[model samples]
Target: MSPKILVVLSSHDKLGDTGKQTGWYLPEFAHPYYKLEGKADMTIISPKGGAAPLDPSSVEMFKEDAEASKFLKEKEALWTNTDKLSNYLGKADQYDGIFYVGGHGPMFDLATDSDSQQLIKEFYEAGKVTSAVCHGPAAFVNVKLSDGSYLVKDQEITAFTNTEEDQVGLSSAMPFMLETKLQENGAKIVKADQPWGVKVVQSGKGGKLITGQNPASAAGIGEAILAAL
Candidate 1:
């Protein structure tokens, strides 16, 4: 069987109280989708189901990238047909792995959704390739493993760093810094020297959890996940 990969996206469109719009970052999803589409069967899911919103700035930023353009033009159905996270909470065994795509949106919903938390834990316990990129790791902030330990505890992982969050100017609006929360959860954070530089980490525990630092690391994360599979 071609491995089935579940791609979870954030459904929250508003970025905290900033009155700014945000959702799944286009390149974060587009880059990985292009990388894994032919090699795996991918399913899209979100908190509310239906069409997940797009981060407007990301759409404009990658407007000219050929792969992104192709994805925008050809994958409209995937955007409209997402399954609700609730629908798959106990079905993690059906998937070979889970990929969380990030934008500012994940910070609002995926970080706290109990269903998403449970699904992530299930995937982790199954010894599957569980992965996330950028703010996508927000989903990992509260996940507890079967042994009642925080999944990220002592794991070598990377996500949108505090410096990158400040550079983006969303720090004040966000509930808390992602890197800090991950650290509080006991993850040993790793980061790239420069913002937008590529950084991907395989969890200290036998490389089951794969993470990427930022949007620029999306394609690399996809490659790593495929290799893990």
Candidate 2:
């Protein structure tokens, strides 16, 4: 049987108070999805279970990329029919890996979700590869490992950087910055020079923990998770 991988997405709806643009980006989820689809039985899940938002800006970024554009159009059903995190937490062991795709949405909802934290801890302790990209790593802040420490503690990982956040003008809107919090939790964070650069970091000899720098690295992140599996 093919390995099953849980792809966690955020259900956050608002980008900022203006509500101008918000949602998961096409490349962030679609690029990884296509890469993993052939290798694993992929399951997409979300915090609230249905209709995850998509950041409007993401659509513009991939407007010229055909594969990304196609995937974005077909993703409506998947987004609208996603399973709630609670539903998957009960059967966390059924999967071989867990991947979190990101946009600005994750910093708001995925960070504080108790179910998300529990599911991440369970999958990690069960020896499944745990991976995330961009702002997706924000969810790791609250995940407590079996050893009573943060899962990211002492782990080498990467995520959306403060510089990128500032460039996007979302620094003040975020509940907390990912890079600072990950470092505070003991992660050795590595980031790319630019947010759109492709960068993936696997912290530990076994490559058990993985994180990608931004949307451009989603394919690399997916490949890394597949390799670890």
Candidate 3:
């Protein structure tokens, strides 16, 4: 059977108080979608069940990249009207894995969303291939095991770092630094050698909690998830 993968995206569109638009980053979703296209069956979804917004800056930034550009032209439906995350609360077992795609939007919504927290807990407890990239790990912040421990606790993974957030000049606008929050949750983050470079990390526990550091690492994140699946 082709592995069924659930791709969760953030539905929030406002970027703090900057009057800027932000949601899922284009490459974060695009790169991974193409990588897994023939290998898995993907269902795109979000908290609100439709129109998961894209970060405008990300769209412009990746506009010149052929793969991202192609995705923008060809995959409108995937991000346009998504299935609601709440609809799959009890159906996680149907999926081989769950991927949380990110932008600044995830930091605001998915990070603290109760539904996201519960769903991630279900996937993690079931030993499914749970994964996220960049700010995507924000979704993991509140997922807890039956034992009441954070799923990410003591897990070695990576996400968009504090330095990277600061470099982007939105650190102050963020609720909290992702790296710091993950650390507080007991996640042992593995940093990339340089900023804006590809870096993917497999979780310390049997490599299930795969994560990537930034936009440049999205494709690597996809490759890693495919291998895990």
lDDT of each: 0.91, 0.85, 0.91
lDDT of 2 by residue, 68-176 (tens): 8888787677777898888887576788889998898888889999999999888888878889999999988778987899988889889999888898888988888
Worst 10 residues of 2 by lDDT: 15-24
The segments of candidate 1 whose C-alpha lies over 4 angstroms from its true place after superposition are none
Off by over 4 Å in 2: 193-195
Q: What is the RMSD of candidate 2?
A: 1.5
Count of residue pairs whose backbone atoms collide, per candidate: 0, 5, 0
Q: Give a tens-digit lDDT track for model 1, residues 1-229.
A: 7999899999999988877898999989999998898899999999999999989988899998888889888998987779998888878888889999989999999999999999999899888989999999999999988899999999999999999989888899898899999999999999998877999999845697999999899999989988887
- How far residue 224's Cα lies from its native spot in candidate 3, in Å, is 0.5
| Ten residues in sequence with the least summed lDDT for candidate 1 | 200-209
TM-score of each: 0.97, 0.95, 0.98
Clash pairs, candidate 1, are: none
The TM-score measured for candidate 2 stands at: 0.95
Query: Which residue ranges in model 3 land beyond 4 Å of their true spot?
Result: none
* TM-score of candidate 3 on Cα atoms, chains taken together: 0.98
List model 3 lDDT by residue over 71-173, tens digit each: 9999999999999999999787888999999899999999999998999888887888899999999999778889999888989878999889989999988
